[model samples]
Target chain A: MATVAAPGTQAYARPALLDWLTTVDHKKLGILYLYFTMFFFAVGGILALLVRTQLAVADSSFVSNNAYNQIFTMHASAMLFLFIIPVWAGFGNYLVPLQIGAADMAFPRINALSFWLLPPAGILMFAGFLVEGGSANAGWTAYSPLAQQSGSGMDLWIISVIILGVSSTIGAANFMVTMFRMRAPGMTMFRMPIFCWTMLVTAVLQLLATPVLAAALTMLFIDRNFGGAFFDPNTGGNAILWQNIFWFYSHPAVYIMILPGMGIISEIIPVFSRKPLFGYKAFVFATMAIGGLGFSVWAHHMFTTGAVLLPFFSFMTFLIGVPTGVKIFNWLGTMWRGSITFTTPMLFGIGFVSMFLIGGINGMFSAVVPIDFAIHDTYFVVAHIHYVLFGGSVMAVFGGFYYWFPKIWGRKLNETLGKWHFGLMLIGFNLAFFPMHLLGLDGMPRRIATYSESGWEALNFASTVGSFLIGVSMIPFLIAVVAAFMRPKDQPDDPWEANTLEWGTTSPPPVYNFDELPEVRSERPLFDRRHPDLAGGGH
Target chain B: MAAIESSPRHEEGMSNGMLGFILFLASEVMFFGGLFAAYFIARADAQEWPPVNLLTEEQIAAGVQLEMHVGLPAIATAILITSSIVIQWAEFQIKKGNQAGLIWGLFITLAMGVIFLAMQMYDYAQLDFGAGDTIYGTTFYTLTGFHGAHVFGGAVFILIVLLRALGGQFSAQRHEAVRACSIYWHFVDVVWIALFTILYIVPE
Candidate 1:
């Protein structure tokens, strides 16, 4: 056999560093998004550790109250803005074009601009801590009046968040154009990959919801800086208006964060189970149904505020569960009685389903107005948020990482290391967040620097242990990634026998995605290519 | 890989740039929708616009009363709406392959845009309120101020299109930029009509 250059060897014309910084190629841009968001993930993770340390014991003095506030605020902000939201963009940027058989994103320069906007926005947001009165301490929601209570850092938070919103909005537009206009010859709307469908829905949500958020942020900025009274009740402005507007965007943002993760899990389950996605059409409709229903449920977040229509929002909140349930059953059906492989990616895929169920059930509980009144601002709500966001989104993020790592880098991650990473993260995630359920049930309020309740300390301590364990879990994942990179880029075109068009191309697909795409007769084009005898028959 | 070659590799749809630009406009609509929502909420919550009772005499002395003077804004609205037509005329001219008409149409649209902006600034100067005065003033200025910013953005977009038109870079079939600019101008005009009715014509 002819000798091949190593995977990381200089294969392109420009020097690697400048090539990356200036390149508008979707794959390179996607890589940049991954590296950037992952770095923020580590930063956000460390901040979370600081938060856990602060709340570990009764009246814990691990950090000062102000510092604790900033840490937790930054933790949420970094995770939500810097990590979770953009990480999906990272995946979509890399995979959507390849999966749809496009050359690059529709607006590649704007694609690069979208990624470039994040660093400065992140810097401006985090730079708040160095300024006077510390960073925004009003929580990530940055509710009005309290949001205005902070210093210039809050200003930075507002401006940076607006910038980030602009970035997401533009990115959403780019994705919509790419998916709508760039599908290959036989890839009909219904025939596209499930992940692309999810991105389509997610992009629609981002396009519509994020701008409302930018408007809300603008109002808050004016209120804070220009003596405006949008949320200041003393001057005839209503605080509930802020809640109304904030949740209007944020409620859909919940889907913006989770749907792509669901998409990733959708891709993972099918590949590992050796089955077509059960109810592929139903799954796509469920995703769109979730997107449409997402807008109506914002008031569910404000049920305790006493200003919203109670029964209407409560009913809508419960109603959203119907489509969500459809998705869960569909995922299970895909894996039912199939040739299931418990690869690391599949483990995380299964992890997402199980954990997101608990999250969904708890969320539904909050939809009950009476139940929400009790746990509105408590650790129970915190637990639910983390379960949905961390357990749901973060798990799928890892699953996507492992599933696509080979395709991206042309080398499989070490399987033993992968299992170790998955196992530790599973244990550590449950250990850390599961106790928050009890702590919340035990009357533990959220966002407090410390707790003084008699019986809450043990669970709190357990949570701290779990959080650090989760932190420790990342060590193996990083090692797996690094170790994977150390090997040669020698993966075949179809490493996992996957079913998407992305697998039809070379591992670490060339600057252009495909040389010649296989004739797409079904959603699982690669599967059809590999098993022509099984074509048009159920596997 | 060099730049992706422009070819009909995928099935036919709107050009990628036009589709992307339209999506951008969709987001812009939502952005304005948010401000309008805030405006309506503020209006619904308030007992009165320009609450003279809430104003101190000293504040009244500081030029913070609510003399809306809808006449100027109405005139500006007409001007902006007409500019949308003028820009559409430019697109029509380009579509029919009339280069000179395209140039003249774009120039008139650009001039109308500048005049509308100047008229708006004039209106802002003549107003007897500031954004910090009350929720009414805050909502008023915030809504109109953001609209004005969009107007400025539209003008800049027109300027770019005009410059391209001057450079003979557009034709009947090659005027995607001109068409995108026209669509954006129409969107701005529609938003202005909504803003004018709510801010001026409505009996709040």
Candidate 2:
């Protein structure tokens, strides 16, 4: 084993462009995903601000209705496809191998292919905005008949989504193979990190779910371009077919977005509390349950469509909360009565729990079939989604970045700036979205370009102001990252004294993760190796 | 305890390549499953079979439309199914260190694959209607087009394996490439059988 070259010795050779293109090194691929997702995030955020600006005034036009439609469409398309999904993949790519003590992902070239496919997909989606009619105006759901309406942009949207679906399928296959085949010896399934377990389930969902989306899009494309009548209500085809296909994929897709964030919380809580995760087995079961239950609840999105059967889907939708509730209790249990440190990651984790609980409760309200009919296409639904996605997923994503920054960059981020960022973001997020619930109940419908004589002006103004504050909050976060890069390195190998295998290695781990892979006796092998007494004790 | 170093035997762990192939096939199953579900849903609501009938007036008048075009597709399916067997034979030969047998078996498989593709294209061209003419034509073409693409991909795999065989890359022990190629060929064959049964054998 010692005869193998030292970690950096293999890094001596300058690699070619083709080598970089084909290289399966998880770290390089992870960085690529990170940088690419950041670009998309910025693009998607700008689109959001543009949409908010349009909504700021009542019947005071900054942009045409068509332009407003394009803005919001691009915003949803960019955020969901390019920003959220790839951001999680970026974190998973970099950290999964490190946590599991594998040298690289199982199928490295396939990994590279997956990352490379995203840029073209993003280009295709944005290209829709450049066309004559502008991007798809029909909401991200892209319901049929609206989606089937011939426009220069609709075909481009279809093509881009299909390409992105292919990329996701390939990536999902790689993750599954890696987790199953490439773990270090003694790293049994139960002993793997919570993040790894979450990723495994997420990949399974992606594998099963994404292809259905691709099929739906393909059918739409055919209906539009080839004169096929798959979704044409005038023909024998049913319009509700599109909704069924879209939500079947989209609901599991919600899990795809949140499950990894849940994993990030699971990791952060156990570390900060200085205890083994309370009810580790229960948490694992909850993750699996979330993935399993995700499929049956998709019809909840169609409650207002009135096309689907109600009681069965509503039951499934409400049942999902049980497993999700179990997760929240497990997290609080982990954080109870321990030597807790309030790191930036922990702050974000706690924020995720609090905000996501509100999001979940609001979701439960929507699950009531009659209530969903009331608020179905209103701003309440909009606010609830943002709370779940932004408050839950985006916050957890930030937590992961802060927690894993030292391992990836070998430099500690400035905690002062992070705290400031977190505080402002939390305030801005609630202020922006919380009032949306009231505005929605007050009878201001969603997807409308303007409102007239409704007394919605005050709430809309408040929401707009909050949106800008959320934008401002990003400044401190970006500045902290810049500061971390600019400062002279001052990070130790294990800055957090973490429990995972990743922290056992050097800061910014060697090209190949470990010189000799350690045999795992428990989930927290590094902690056990370093502190035997703590391993045996509850705390 | 002695610290053993640099053991070549460590490389003998269960093959990653084979495991990767199985996982890839699993994903493919989900992909095809989605398409099949679409077909099932579409068929369920289908009020009259073949919504826009494509049979020529003479054939419809004479009732020849009900007659099966079994001979051509059966030949094609036979060629594809037989190619799978021959590809496996090639893999077995390569594993046994029989270079001549491996080359001949691979050559035969490739020839049979090309014949199957040609027959498939002929069958597609001979369709009485275009894809946009009717719903039956649309579903038929889309499903079969996707199947053809898979066959084309399988052909490329076989061609690459044949080229590698020519270059003397495989031996008795290290033959994962051959095994993976054989598995892919078999998968394509299985897909063709399903397509044949659904599109041809099942009465409209």
| Each model's chain A TM-score | 0.97, 0.97
Q: DockQ winner among the candidates? A: 1
The regions of model 1 sitting more than 4 angstroms off are A1-12, A537-539, B1-13, B61-63
The TM-score obtained by model 1 is: 0.96
In terms of lDDT, the poorest run of 10 residues in model 2 chain B is B1-10
Clashing pairs in 1: none
Query: i-RMS, every candidate?
Result: 1.1, 2.9
Candidate 2 regions exceeding 4 Å error are A1-11, A15-23, A516-519, A536-539, B1-14, B53-71
- lDDT tens digits, residue span A297-331, model 2: 88889977877889999999889999899999988
**Candidate 2 docking band:** acceptable
